[model samples]
Target: MGSKNISITEDAYERLKAHKREGESFTDVIVRLTEDERDIMSGFGAWSGTDKGDHARKAREQLNAEFEDGR
Candidate 1:
């Protein structure tokens, strides 16, 4: 694999260092943090199968009523 040298401010460097585990490199910490974020949406697509559709419809009706009342 190829590599590049990037620079960060002291504050940014400290933040990354804080996230690094024992014996882990900055690259590892960054990859771990980013990969963790990707898993967030893994089950979000299943929302339609739950009560989310009904909840959304009810919320929309409530919002519409509030808007009509304000008019």
Candidate 2:
């Protein structure tokens, strides 16, 4: 595998460092954070099979209404 050198601001470096688990590489930390986020929206549906769909749908509707009202 090939890796490229990239530069980040000190603040950004520290943020990633803070998220790194013990014995975890910076690359692993970054990939874990980003990959989970990419599928987070789809994750809520997994709860829908357990009778949580109505609650989840109501929450979504309330959130949408609040945003529409400029809250």
Candidate 3:
């Protein structure tokens, strides 16, 4: 595998080191930190269903009414 060298300030280095576990390399910590497993498609079509669409519309209407009343 290929590697790159970058510089970090002492404070940044200390923060990364603080997250390091026993017998774990800084490379492992970096890899673990940079990996993202959040569902990218989670909200892509979340309101595609009829029920969700209706619920969202109602919520928006309620919010708008409340704001108009406050004003």
Candidate 4:
């Protein structure tokens, strides 16, 4: 793999470094900071229709029931 070199300001470097976790590289920090965890397509439809799917379905049903009962 090839790497690219880019220049960042002193404050930018410090901020990026502040987000660095133990055992994580600068690239990891950049990706974690830049990637949108809430993007539907990113993790959407990736469930295997097992544990998580079952729980979410149950939660939705419970929530709907609560609203229906006005509780």
In model 2, what lDDT does residue 52 have?
53
lDDT of 3 by residue, 31-50 (tens): 88888778885775465564
lDDT of 3: 0.85
lDDT of 2 by residue, 1-71 (tens): 89989999999999999999999999999889888556555666565453657777888999999999999
lDDT of 1 by residue, 8-65 (tens): 9999999999899998988989889888555665665376545556776887899999
The TM-score between candidate 1 and the true structure equals 0.60
In order, what lDDT does every prediction score?
A: 0.82, 0.85, 0.85, 0.86
Where model 2 places Cα greater than 4 Å from the true spot, the runs are: 39-71
Per-model TM-score, in order, reads 0.60, 0.53, 0.60, 0.49
What does the lDDT read for residue 65 in candidate 2?
100
Rate residue 59 of model 1 by lDDT: 77
Which portions of model 3 show Cα errors greater than 4 Å? Answer: 37-54
Worst 10 residues of 3 by lDDT: 44-53
Ordered list by lDDT, greatest first: 4, 3, 2, 1
TM-score of the candidate numbered 4?
0.49
